[model samples]
Target: MQVTQNIKAPEMLIDYYKAIEDSSARMLEAAKHHDWDEVVRCEGACAVLIEQLRYRSQDQELPPEQRKEKTRIMQRILRNDAQIRILAEPWLAQFDHPFEGKPQVLH
Candidate 1:
């Protein structure tokens, strides 16, 4: 089999992108309605999905400074979330990408 066969199809990847866009839209909806809780929930869910999307680094070897940066990020991977969504909301909105889901509480 060719290596490309194991790779994800472009549309599947685009759907994932659209899901994220919809997720952002959901946040925008929540914000428009002044629903901070829903904003927090939707943004956090999208962040979790992005983390899951990361593939293993092909370049396993890193220079010393880069290694330290990677170590810091890896350490954060274990830390409990500390209400990061609050800070994240305005910043994400400033980027102006459209997301599309009707706002609803998932948990």
Candidate 2:
């Protein structure tokens, strides 16, 4: 008898991507409510997850069977990022406007 693995690829990648999607969704909700702080916090969390995913991916490649699922997840992430950027544009413009007339300060 031969032992076989059930996972097509390292499931950790899927889990990490899912976690990022969940955080992106949360950020979208917070942005909808104009909760900029919470959105920032969630964005921070997403960044950390992204770093971990990158590190993990450096050592593991997704199997052919799992590539399709990864592509779908990536699409969803892109859509979420787009929506979040749309929601944040006005808030970002507001911040920019306040500094438009100020002299640039060199640190």
Candidate 3:
């Protein structure tokens, strides 16, 4: 008798990636509308998701097939991040311009 099978990959890892992607999408929407507060909120959420993903990755490895999927997801995430930064640079410069000559307060 011969058996052919592949071990199943853990679903939790995929879930974490999905959650991060969702957060990035939300951030993109917020950035489009110039809603920095919402973007920051989503950014915080993404940070937490990243920490969770890091912890999960220490113990779980994706299957070979899923590796491709993970790569695609990561690419989308990077694209979202790049666009967000592009949208934010001018707004950030506006903030910086006002404080350039102000006295610094040390706390």
Candidate 4:
């Protein structure tokens, strides 16, 4: 017989936060390696996870203990994002004038 385990709502919400933190870490790693493509992929993953977290959070509230852990996870994610932005600054500067001489069209 196969058994399945059901996670509680608060736990599930923490899991989403952990997943997002993980994806943000990966994005930072990719940025450090100058792998913009992988960074973008990880960023997309983080976006999806964020959306899922928002949806799951609609009716779920974490308990005090889990809230502390979520705060830690959020802090890590923010740190990773800060590092990634620093790493990407040079690469992003390349697009500073991408449309400098292009004509603008209003729709």
Best by lDDT: 3
How do the residues 48-100 of candidate 2 rate in per-residue lDDT, one tens digit apiece?
Answer: 88888899999987778878888888898888889989999998997867878
TM-score preference between candidates 1 and 3, better one? 3
Error of 1 at 97 (Å): 30
Cα lDDT tens digits for candidate 3, 1-107: 11112223325788778778888888888888898888888888888888978988999887788788888999999999999999999988987778687898889
What candidate 2 gets wrong by more than 4 Å, as runs, is 1-11, 99-107
User: lDDT (0-100) at residue 85 of candidate 4?
Assistant: 95
Q: lDDT per prediction?
A: 0.49, 0.77, 0.81, 0.80
Score residue 41 of candidate 2 by CA lDDT.
83
Q: How many backbone clashes does candidate 1 have?
A: 3
Give TM per candidate.
0.41, 0.77, 0.80, 0.80
Q: What count of clashes does model 4 give?
A: 0
Mark the 10 consecutive residues where model 3 has the least summed lDDT.
1-10
Which regions of candidate 4 deviate over 4 angstroms? 1-11, 99-107
Model 1, 1-107: lDDT tens digits are: 11111122223333333444455656655656666677677677667545544432232334455555545544443231233355456767856855445475678
- The deviation in Å at residue 65 for candidate 1 is 36
